[model samples]
Target: MFDQRKQDSLAAWHKLATQAQQWMDPEQQYDELLKAADEMEEKGLITSSEWRQLVRDAGSVFTGSQEHKTH
Candidate 1:
């Protein structure tokens, strides 16, 4: 029961993570995500480490901004 619950939780996490990754686009999505993170940090809703991890995950999804061209 406990093990099953743990597995379920992990699966849910993965699904959410994947859905988040798919939203990286148009720059606005990243901007909105960062804004939310900033608000969360300001409100003490999330730790610095958590914010950093979110930024890293967002970076992985978007790679770079449109202003910057990758060679």
Candidate 2:
């Protein structure tokens, strides 16, 4: 079973992701995600690998938003 800290981490990440999706500015969203990921990793809420994955996923969001903007 996952511990409290692990559960808290998942909850935090889920909240962040949901909020990021609602932002009108993709750059701002991506930046926020990176910042949050850094904070989470520093607090040991997420692993380095998870941080990398978050960054990669943020890039995808940024790119997709840009494409929509150009269309």
Could you list the CA RMSD of all candidates, in the order they appear?
6.5, 2.6
Model 2 lDDT per residue over 1-71, tens place: 33687677667665765566665487787787778778878888778998898888778767887897899
Give the candidate number with the greatest lDDT. 2
lDDT of 1: 0.57
Off by over 4 Å in 1: 1-24, 64-71
As a TM-score, model 1 comes out at 0.52
Q: Pick the candidate with the highest TM-score.
A: 2
Residue 14's lDDT within candidate 2 is 57
Model 2 worst lDDT run, 10 consecutive residues: 15-24
Write the residue-wise lDDT of candidate 1 on 10-61 in tens digits: 4543354455545555365566556666665676656799778766765654
**lDDT values, one for every candidate:** 0.57, 0.75
lDDT, residue 25, candidate 2? 81
- Measured with C-alpha atoms, the lDDT of residue 33 in candidate 2 is 70
